[model samples]
Target: MWISPAFHLKVIRAYDALVTQQPHPGAIDIRDPKQLAIVALQLVEVNRDLQAKVDTMQVAVDAHHRIAKASAGSRCVTDAAKDLQVRPKDLFSWLSANRWIYRRPGGSGWLAYQDRIQAGLLEHKVHTVERPDGTDKVVENLLVTPKGLAKLAVAFRTPNAA
Candidate 1:
C-alpha cells in the first residue's frame, strides 16, 4: 500500500485526464464516464502481471533449497570453496566463528573440531605433497559430513550471520 512518488504523480495525471474533459482544464463540454473506468482497469492489469512474476520466483527458490539440503556431503575445504564459487576466506570465516573447525598450537592449517569429529559430523585426513626441490611434506585437513556441510552452507550463504 506504499505508493512511490513517481506512481503518485502518475495516478494524479490519470485522474486529471479522465475526469476533466478539457485537456488544459477550463471545462470543455464532452465528459465520458467510460474513459475513467478504462484507466482504472489498466492499473489492475499491471498489478496482476507483476504479482505473477513474484510467485514464480518464489517457487524456484524453494526447490533449490530442498535439493541443496539433500545433496550435502563430505568435501575438502578447497574443493567445497571452489564448488560454491566463493573465496576460501569466506568459508574459513564461517568455520572459525561456528567452532566447527580449529587450529592446534603451531599448526599450519585448519583442523576438525574435536567434538564434531567425535560426533561423526566430521573426519580428518592426511596427505603427502612433493615440492619442486624433491622434498615431501605431510598435510592434515578436515572432511565434513553431509549433515555438517548442509548446516554450514546455510551459515555461509546467509548475510552477516543473520
Candidate 2:
C-alpha cells in the first residue's frame, strides 16, 4: 500500500486532464475526447505497471526478511536474498528496468523513484543548501497537495467517465 507520492500525483493529474478536456471540433468530434483519453490511460497504465513490480519485490523481500529474523542472526539484505534467492545484481536489474530503482555500483539500488515522489510532493520547489565545509546538504521532502493529486487523477481517468 506504500504507493509513491509521484505516481499518486500522476494519477491525479491524469484524472484532472480528463475532467478539464475541452472539445476540439476540428481535431476530433466534440462528443469524444479521444486523444486526451488515450493519453490519460497511458499515464495510468505506466503507473500501474511500475507499481505492480514494486509491490511484487517488496512482498518477496518482506517474506524473506521475516524468515531470516525468526532464524536469528540474519541481516536484512541476507534475508532478502535468501527469501527471494535472487542475485543482488539481478534484483537491481529488475528494479532498474521498472524505473523504480537505480543501480548504485557497490551499493544496493538507490530509491530514485522515492526521491522523485518526494520532490513532486514538495510542489516542485527544492532548495539545495551547501555547507561551508564543502559537504552536500539534504533536501526537504516535497508535499503533494490536493491540487496536484486532482490534476493527476483527471489525467488518468477514463475519457468516457468524464
Candidate 3:
C-alpha cells in the first residue's frame, strides 16, 4: 500500500500536462482511444511492479518481526554484538557514542541512558556478588532488549548509520 514519491510526481506531472493541454512524456491523450488503452495497460504494468516491491518489503518486515519475537528477552552486550556481527568493544563504543549507554561516574560497568530504558531499548538486571568478607554487593548489568536488537540490526545494515 506504499506509494512511492516518484509515482506521485508522475501523477502530478501528468495531471498538470493534461490541464495545461501540453504534451508531456507521462501525459496521455484522452481523445485517442488507442492512446488511452495504451496508458491503461502501462498503468497495469506499473501496478504490478509496485505490488512486487510491496511483497518484497513485506517479507523483509515479517522476517525482522519473527527475529525480534524469537529473541523475546534482554541480552548482554557481548551476545548482542555477536548477533549484530560487530566486535563487542566496537558495539560498546557505538552505543556510548550514540548516547544509548554510558559508564557510571566511577564505575566500570555500562549503564543505560534514562531515555533508552524508557523507550524499552535497554534494561538493567541486578546481580548479587559475595565478597571475600561474606558481604553481598548488588551489581547492575545493562542489557539490550529484543526490540533494541532488531533496531540495531537495521541501523547497522544501513549505509552511513551512526
Candidate 4:
C-alpha cells in the first residue's frame, strides 16, 4: 500500500521510539526513504492491530445504546450503567481502514452493524439478478468470512486485557 510522505515520517518517528528499546551501537546514514518507510510501516501496522481492538470494543459498547432504550433504564440506575455511548469519530478512526466495519454516523441511534469480510466470519451470499435500471447485467456481492469475525472478536475484548 502506498503512503504519503508526511504519514511516512510519522511512522518513522514511531519506529525510532521502538528501536530505542533494543541495543544497537553504530553510526548510520538516514537519507533512505524506502528504508525509513519500511520501519515506519511496521510500527504503524502494529498500532493498527491495536487500534482494531479498540474499534471493535467501541462498536460493541456503542451497540448497547439500543438495548438501553428498550430496557428503559429499569435494570440500572446511573446513566453510565445504562449505555456504552462511544463517539462516532473515535469508532470511525479505528475501523475506516478495514472496509467491513460499518456503523451509523453519530452517537445517537442504534443503527450500527459490523461483519467480517475476509475468510472466517463468512456472512456473504451471492445473487445474480437484473440490474435495478432493468438492464441485462448482473452484479457480484462480496461477503465477509469467519477469519474476519475472529479478528473483530479479538478487538472486542476489554480495553486493558493483557
For each candidate, how many residue pairs have backbone atoms clashing (under 3 Å)?
Answer: 0, 28, 0, 13
Error of 3 at 147 (Å): 0.7
In order, candidate lDDTs are 0.69, 0.48, 0.82, 0.45
- 3 or 4: which has the higher lDDT? 3
Which residue ranges in model 4 land beyond 4 Å of their true spot? 1-29, 75-162
Residues 49-114, model 2: lDDT tens digits: 999999756654454443433343312322333334546565446535755345457953254456
Alpha-carbon lDDT of model 2:
0.48
* TM-score between model 2 and native: 0.23
Residue-level lDDT of model 1, residues 1-162, one tens digit each, is 798999999889878888884375544334666766776788899999999998756554543464364446677776666544468888878778878788889977888778988887678888999988999988776877655655555445533221
Report the error of model 2 at residue 117, Å.
39
Measured by TM-score, the strongest candidate is 3
The C-alpha TM-scores of every prediction are 0.46, 0.23, 0.62, 0.26
Report the Cα RMSD per candidate: 14.4, 23.2, 11.9, 20.2
On the 0 to 100 scale, the lDDT of residue 33 in model 4 is 82
lDDT by residue (tens digit), candidate 4, 81-122: 213243445434444455544545673322113434333333
Q: Pairing residues by index, what is the TM-score of model 4?
A: 0.26
Better candidate number, 2 or 4, judged by lDDT: 2
Error of 2 at 53 (Å): 0.5
User: Compared with the true structure, what per-residue lDDT tens digits does model 3 show for residues 1-162?
Assistant: 899999999899889978998987756679989998998999999999999999767654753654554466889989888766678998999999999998878988999999999999899999999999999999998898888887777666433222
Question: How big is the RMSD of model 3?
Answer: 11.9
**Per-residue error (Å), model 4, residue 137:** 67
